[model samples]
Target chain A: MADVKDVDWDAVMADSRFQSLRRKKTIFLWVLMVFSMTYYFVLPLGAAYFPHVFQIKIWGVLNVGLLFALSQFVVAWAVAFCYERRASGQFDVLAKEIVVAFHQQEPRR
Target chain B: MRASRAWSSVILCVISVLVALMPNVALADATVIGGEWRALTLTVFAAVIGLTIYVTYRSASHVKSAADFYAASGSISGLQNGWAIAGDYLSAASFLGIAGLIALNGYDGFMYSVGFLVAYVTVLLVIAEPCRNIGQYTLADILAYRNDPKLSRIFGALSVITVSTFYLTAQMVGGGVLVKTLIGIDYEVSVIAVGVLMLGYVIFGGMVATTWVQIIKATLLVIASIVLVMLVWVPYGFSLPDFMADVVGDPKVQARVAALLGDSSTVMTPSELGQRFLEPGLLYKMPVDQISLAMALVFGTAGLPHILMRFFTVHDAQQARKSVLWAMAIIGGFYVLTLILGFGAAHLVGPAAISAVDAGGNMAAPLLAQYLGGGRDSFWGNFMLAFVSAVAFATIVAVVAGLVLAAASAMAHDLYVGVLRAGRQVSSGQQVAAARVATLIVGAMAILIGIAAKGQNVAVLVGLAFAVAASANFPCILLTLYWRRANTAGMVAGMVVGTLVAVGLTLVSPNLTYPLQKIAAANKVLDAEQAKRTAIEAVLQNPWPQSESLIVKARAEQVALDKAIRLAQADIKKYEGQSRSFMGLKEPLISLKNPGVISIPAGFLAAILASLWIRDERARAKWSELYVRQNTGMGISKSVSH
Candidate 1:
């Protein structure tokens, strides 16, 4: 546990780095969340609303609907990969720095 | 007392297994159930039981503390946790049910699998990290952090218990039917055995045992599915087009399908039939219900108490994120295989044989496994069938263990410790004891419900559970983390109203029974007529002492009854059409089979409006603390080191 009591909450809250990390993460996650949600809804929506369009044969047995549904697995994997990259690379580093700063200043208080 | 109860249940499981193995036991009428494969299937089942007993014993010694019991001492790594998550998440519903659905209803079943996989994206991006950072043991911990602990714990415990119990019942019922059909065990015995095993896991081993059970089950399930897929693919030269073409051109498949459609006279060309099967409208005719079900799955997965509770088992936010990523890969890959499994069953097992065994097509996967191993008479065929059945049975037991543990945690940690004790400090031993006792109660309730729901469609219950989770649980958890203005009243209103509306809509909706009730009524009458015919035919077989006139009259009556029975069966098929609603109504009160589309938004809106409508200063005051901790992972407990 990070010794929540000794660290100064008001100061940490005002830290510019902490503020930036939160903003960046919030925007990145929401955008990803929104995009994934929209991309997913398209499968059910297209299959239901435009049956003829989705029925267009793309291959011997594969139709547009089947292909679209299969593509979702790829898309979900891609989204997870992207989020993992960003989270591990950028978000965790920034959050770790904030944690370090608070802990380093705790003894001086 | 609790220990004795647990022992008795285990004894019951042993007795039932013994009885099921006895020679010349009364078998079900279904040809699929028991024949020559009983030894192999029971051996496989015994192996799984042996594994559970060993794992639970090992975990029991380590489960001395509350943390050990609840979060497996936070020792599970990302990879193992990922597999466990897959095991817990992929119920027999996904493995057996969806594959069967795909085999029976082509494109629509694949659509369901898509939503299931894509739902993980929501979990990864939103729920995983924050939940791990802010919560401990139960989901209620997260809420209690920023709101009134008592109020939040109470509601949280209530929703968790409700969702988990609803989900547990579905698994228990599915387990019962699946076991009975595959091995010819009685449904009551199957339900009791499953309940006993699940209770043994949760009561003795807690999360650690549950996690390992899930991990082992998941590995077995995935490997079995891959092997099945490969076996299926080999016959078609590993070519997709070849498989599709064969599936379409196979005369047996077409005839069986025609029979299933109840229109053998009107035969479409193979290509046209292929087009119809490959298209999207076979099972789900309603676009609205599709959208509703899709929404529920994508949102509801994030809110499942069992899934969410997994995060607490990991050490930190980063591990939690990694676990979800791992889960996504395994689950996504598994779902892709389901397409082949489904289509393969349709091609190999034939729809006629599949439905002849179980109407819901639940037997498609297992039967397909048998066929790919060379048909029912072959040794390899029965061995492969028993393997898949055992893996599926393990799948159900693992999932139910997770659910029972989650509910017990809510009952013990959230309700008893947090609310009843008013957040007083409880000894670790006492907490563990409470959880064990809670497991017994919950397991008993599930067993009774599973037995009572025998032969009834519990698929609706699964849908209802998802809708409730999405509507009631998701909105509150999401708002608590994001919305600074979210207050206790708003959260309360959201849960109460969300649960009410979702459940209310489902009760009135076509999901309860529209055509199903009407068809079931017709079936009852048809069954009686068929039974009467069978009796007369039996009497006619021994007519040496009877008069010729009587024998001739009985033969004539049997012939007439056959025609009457066929007509009655066709009458039942007529009610299969979805255009007609329940209770003689032209349309259902709510046409959407899943209530997510309406109820999910209602939950969010209620929370938002209630928050905006009412003010709570204390909640707003604590937002900064929660915000920092959630984002930075500060104050999160380390892995318990005992």
Candidate 2:
């Protein structure tokens, strides 16, 4: 509800640290994407092709597909945890900075 | 020479060691598989069709303007709209899939119930108002906004096609499976019938007819589900918890429960699987599958092209929000009934009844009612299951129609009219004609996919679609709502990546290997034996020695595999006591034959990344404020034409 156009885009972009951090964030994201897909999509394929390739004997009762699918649960929890704190926080800030900058620029226009 | 080749002995020992573990063996039992009831079935189906058509025309009279045709205008009351949302949301996943999962998986089937319920929290909190507030026609209005109509058109078209194809696939499969088994209509014809019927609903009355049909069906289904649940629990005395505890405590039930809890080792041979549930595993404790299913539930509802489009029919964001909340209540109640249905199948009929009713455990609930109410031969009982099955068929048919309508709307309204024609004003007759023709075309498209996926598990494929929708659309739609930093580049990136990963996952996943029913029938005796041997060998070895010539194993190698299995089961148990848990969790698998639960958040992760990627400076500045402000001031319907 606040006037987002009144925030300072010039001051926000002037900060060089956001630029350095953005580059690191991009690299980290690509790495995250690869690992997530491997477990969620790729490993499931491997498990199907050879069901026994990845069996843990104590888990001998559980099939590889079940294990793989279940990891999604763990990953999801970890991901959600990370997101609520790290990703959500960063995005919220990023969002705030941009919205405020737009608010600031509007009065000048 | 014998001494020099000693290295071969070691190598052979290692190979044999690995080879011994390769095959899983389990016991065998006989199962009586049943078909959908025909004579009693068609009468019920005919009745539903008659009802839907009568309601269709009755509702059509309400639509008199372009606004009326496209949005169903403002005639739909909140209760009607909410019921319609329930009708739309049920899809294959809620109706056929969850029921089937319970039939097969036992208590864990409730995971879907939970996933669906919890996701609405996200929906109510994150999506409902924003979607109602931000855009119209499709997700495109929100995502593309004032920048590019072309972009909106592209994304809208893609979203519609993906959702429609997947939705249509499930409906057609449900129809074909029912028809082939029911009145013995060919599967292809069943699919065609569904496609045409759906197109007719959308083409004749557009959203108005579709909305009323959904409301009517949702009402019937919810009422039926409640009645069925109450009936199941009442016979065991009026005490619900006691009945459940009694069911849980039974040894036969407990064994199935153990198998369910056991996780990986519990793949049932065709025989052991009959009317039995495998145990639960560590997977249960972690709630991973709950996550995957939950992601599907949360993201799937939000991103559904048809469901999202339905909100446009409402006048304001508040109405849309109210509609969603009411729909959630309806959905929650329907799912609770399903929990009764699943446990009832497990509790009352045992695994035997479901194994008799349908090859997949999905039929457990219907079978539970059929068996409990009395066998199919009982005059009233004959129609109970037949009624459920017929409604199941209609449910699929309704869903497929909604999907085709959504796709058709995209092709006609956004693509043909909005994009190609631009500022040119087409006549109302022409617009109506184009929409009908597009419906026909999309209808044809649905029929084709449905036929292609004919014999496959309709529910699993629907889950696959949930994965794709969660991956591709949810991120773009949700992030654009709250995250002002989100830009066009980021939105585009997320949609593309999410879709690619989802489709890729589906291609590689176990779905392809598992749905072998449609292929030319192999000697099920040998296949069943292998399934039996695999279920057996999974545990240890054959407890039953060479038996009489009744059940035959085809290959000679199977005999050797059986011996090795006996050796391993003996060796493993002798070495490790039965008292221990693995990694402080229950065993990971209860049954290999039936996959009951999957953690579904990978799809959401795709969404999260895609949402976070927008980097363009200028676009980010303008777009951020637009999300919260636009709908608060402009109203939802105003953006529909724009």
Candidate 3:
């Protein structure tokens, strides 16, 4: 029981039920990474790069920094919602398949 | 009765609107309990749990095997582990620092919250499953999977010591600060108290008690913070703008708070001109420091030695992953609440909330509670303040206990038994005893350090630890998982170099400078006012019944001295003679150089270099033995440790 180790990558990819789930997980991961990396760039560059903060005034008052910050909250919320939705259905199905496959593996020769 | 209740609220809303529309000095002075409540809450909570953990670990420890000590026999539920992660990860700096920062700087504080959340994705996608797949007991287990026991043990021991020490110092400092604030004990006493208690807890009960205590603290803190947030947001009903408006309307409150925060104001006053030196600009100023600070949060959170160790407590990789997600959820909510709590304090209490009279208020949230809640002179109000303060202390203790355990475990289990003399098994009882002794040593060290750095930024201490972990530990672990040619030599170099560079840079970095406070202030004098004259003036005023004219002259002199001192502090001329700054390179590109202040990014470039130094091993055969053994125990990972 203690000897279990390694993944059957071939079987996981070939399995029809798991394929979409795997793809979704990959996409989700990348999306999350992009958002974060983008976040790093945003904080450093927002004041310099964005003209909205300097030039464009919304309602004759609030400028670009405030707008950009406000948008960040919305974007974060959106990403979280996306994660919860995908994780509930797509990720869950994938996890089950992976776990099931593991449990069913043949003993070592 | 219903109408009367409705009328009361309506009248209050009208009053609130009026207050927001004009500058009200009376409202600003409206009895701020100062920031004492956070300190108070911190003291109680830390005392209870710190003491409990220490006593339990020292006296009742029965850890016979490494499995018992490190994994708790893999008996903990994912949820329990999940909560413990929150308790452990949300160290004192997180609770007090993030909240206080936001109160002073607006949305920048929220940025810290997001940076923390983002790192989980990195962990979830890249590290978590692989870490679970690789080794048991510690990170060394994974890094040295293919190497000799001797090799693994060395790396493992090193990993344990470095990660545990870095994490523990942050925890101890945080605990000490909270204790000093809440209970009015000196910082030294607070540090010693925390260290002793944490050592005892780990020594007695090991993982079982640590897990339970952390989970309890996490839940309680989250609940309490959420309560405070809701009160601030919906004191009568939920209107976010109304709350902000109230904060904006009081100029005296704004001036006082703006002064206390130094250069954080969006709007500048002539009075605020002095603090402008500290106000970080968007990108170029402390750019490297800022980026490093953010990176420290993002990557450091993922690779913390103790945090990864807790993952082993769960049954499978899936459970570990689930626990991480759950922790993120709880912690995310808490961060949001912290924003509200901080703003509430700054708005309701102002800067006066923080004082020597009620030392705990430096913790921010308490200062906020007093502002939003009631009169400190009143019994019910004071009790509420005391309760919150106690809880904050407990939070610190919970965190310290976990860190102390991690460090102690390294010394006893990894260094002494595993590496020092390999193949000679130590009995569980012996292991527990060794761990207990180690705990005491670590606790003592933490107390000494914590006392030395009293009232320092809890956030910065935690950040430095994170920077070290991310630089040294993360690089090594990642390379081991993905890179096959990652010889033990390369791994060792990467880990050691990474740890040293990150730690060294952090110590010498520009962000270490606190606002407006500097070395020049310590050594120099402005105008003709000397220390002798100031002291004499004070003595003269006290001893004699001074004439009105004499009083006027003395007061004017005092005011002039204050102004001159402020002017001297504002402009510090630095002569950089052949100065190559900290990150081992000369020019820093990303720190706060202008307004809308952000940190510099020199640390990021350094970390990237540090990470790149670890080459990915390409040999597949390195994982062959493990490849065949994969499909068996609890079905976790088929991946190879590089």
Candidate 4:
């Protein structure tokens, strides 16, 4: 690895592709974080405040509460899958390009 | 080769000592296992130990540098590391505690399982890739990359040791208790055995052996859970409808459900009992408690040192990301099965029988295994019990090893090398040696504390560990990574305030003892009256006093006894609320058991306000370097193979 001072981090930070990568990654992560946090909190709040709503049975012994709890597992997995796809498919490529471009500019280092 | 020989000798010494101690300890026990099963379970436990030793020796030969000791030389694949992460995260608490909690509390218990899995989402999306890109060995490396190195390493090591030690002791104590109850091992002996085994893994095998141990344990645990779930469903003909029918319609289940409800006047029907059990608010009546605990679970995991260290074991940021995804899948699936296991125990084993063996219901999984295999007298039942017991033992040992490794790294790598010998030339050989010594010390201390805290409530320690991680470590790491203005002052202040507020709130919260002076005074008066009644009853029981004076005295004593009984009853009625709040207040100072809801905001605020209040040119100038490195993985350290 090259020294920190030799890398010209400021130039790399100002690059358009790197900027785009950060923009897209941050926005996608923020959305998922917000959605998941809201969905996670709802389990405790909904179950505690509205017990009767959760108590309404849907199938045999399975109720809305149980279904909602189980759905959290699905939503969490889905979020992970979506992020993996986006990150590996797009973000990783942009990151690789940015690294390669930087290396080309500082070939001596 | 010489070191390998020395390790083998040490291993042999430890094994011989344990073997010598077992017979004396076994004689002292009210052994839980009977007849041939006792020897069978012991043999299985021996096999587990033998396998650990074999793996440790294999990795011991490969551990040649600090990287190998601290991060397994970064050769572990993404999928393998994921299993290791799951192994570290899924402690005995998750396997046994949650299952037992669900069996007893129904929906409320299952709520804990969901939060535990969803916690990984926060780790995956927010923390994983960036952490992998920036950090070399510990979380301190990330902070030191941009901020003040000495300050960051010091506070980082402090928080890591704090979180890991508390968690370590809790797991050790839990292991001792579980082993004693399930397999009838002495508590002290079990704690020492586990502690020694953990040290062997961390000191000799280092991270490589620890990772493999975790992977194998995780596989075994998952397979065992699947088998248990299948057994629970097989009797229902592998149909969900049939299972649900029996769960709600079975007379035995209804009886156990009613017993849990604790309402004796009206006998609730099977369907009604099932509905009540399926609904929430049974164990946690307070909504705030529920929210507070959920917040801690979701955010706290991202800050765990052991979990974060797993990222560095992978080759690159992409592998790190992949590993988190794999962990989420395994952990999520495991939790989902816990729901079935919980209800299965309730229906098949009955809460009555489950709690009868262990009041905490921690033995639910093992007991369920026994029933599923056949019954107590059956051969398969005994085998399943032994198998589950061995798995629980492996789970505890694997988790403690991960924790000891994390704490040892903080001490040796972060504290000794980064802070104590700052800017000094240190050899990799010295670093590895220091880590081994630290592991031995930390592991031993945990064993001692675990034994001393034999019957203490472990829930408080687990809660405090999470609270500290979420409030102290999480904020500092997050801000250092993203906030450009995060300076030395801000980082230090954030950690100090975060840790203080978390611990302070927990101390004042209802999780600890509240002053009940009034109840104590009331109890004093009640005791006096009861003692008077007992004295009068003793005098009245003697019929040999035939004299007129003696008869008169006996009659007077009987009259006094009546008054004493009346007074004692009145006093008991007056102070019926012994557990009422201090100073006659309706609630304690802080009602929330978990302090995340308040302390987490406090931690973040402390960091932001301090950063905005103070300015540092050096920190501001380094932000771009960290940012470029974090986003694009530039200039990150490559894995050391030699």
Q: Model 1, range A34-63, lDDT digits (tens) per residue?
A: 999999999889988899988888888678
Predicted structure 3, TM vs. truth:
0.73
Clashes of each: 0, 55, 80, 0
Q: Residue by residue across A1-109, what tens digits does model 3's lDDT show? A: 2234344544544566555654566677777768856865476355434434433444322334444544554555455556656665666556665656655777444
Compose the digit string of candidate 4's lDDT tens values, residues B524-639. Answer: 65566656556546655666643443333344444434544555566466656565543344346867888889999998899888888888777899998888888888866653
Task: Let me know the DockQ for model 2.
Answer: 0.04
- Candidate 1 matches the true fold with a TM-score of 0.89
What is each predicted model's overall lDDT from 0 to 1?
0.83, 0.58, 0.57, 0.82
Q: After superposition, how far is residue B522 of candidate 2 from its true place, in Å?
A: 12
TM-score of 2: 0.67
DockQ, each predicted model: 0.71, 0.04, 0.26, 0.73
Docking quality category of candidate 2 according to DockQ thresholds: incorrect
lDDT for B124 in candidate 2 is 49
Worst 10 residues of 2 chain B by lDDT: B24-33
**Candidate ordering by DockQ (highest first):** 4, 1, 3, 2
Error of 4 at A36 (Å): 1.1
For residue B577, model 3's alpha carbon misses the true position, in angstroms, by: 21
What is candidate 2's lDDT per residue for B1-642, written digit by digit as tens? 332144234334433432342231111121111233344554576677667876665655554455566677655666677788888878654775677676556534544454565454455445655676666556676776633566656765786688668766776787677645434455676676666666656766788888877877887788768778888777767654555555544444544443343334234332333222322321233343444454566567677787777777776655665676677678777776776677677767775445444555656656665775577667566677767766666677677777777887788878888788978998766776777788888887777877777666566567766676677677777666656566666666667767776665555443443222212122233344456566545434455554421122212224434443554454444434332222222222232211222212443454456446635564566562454344232223455443
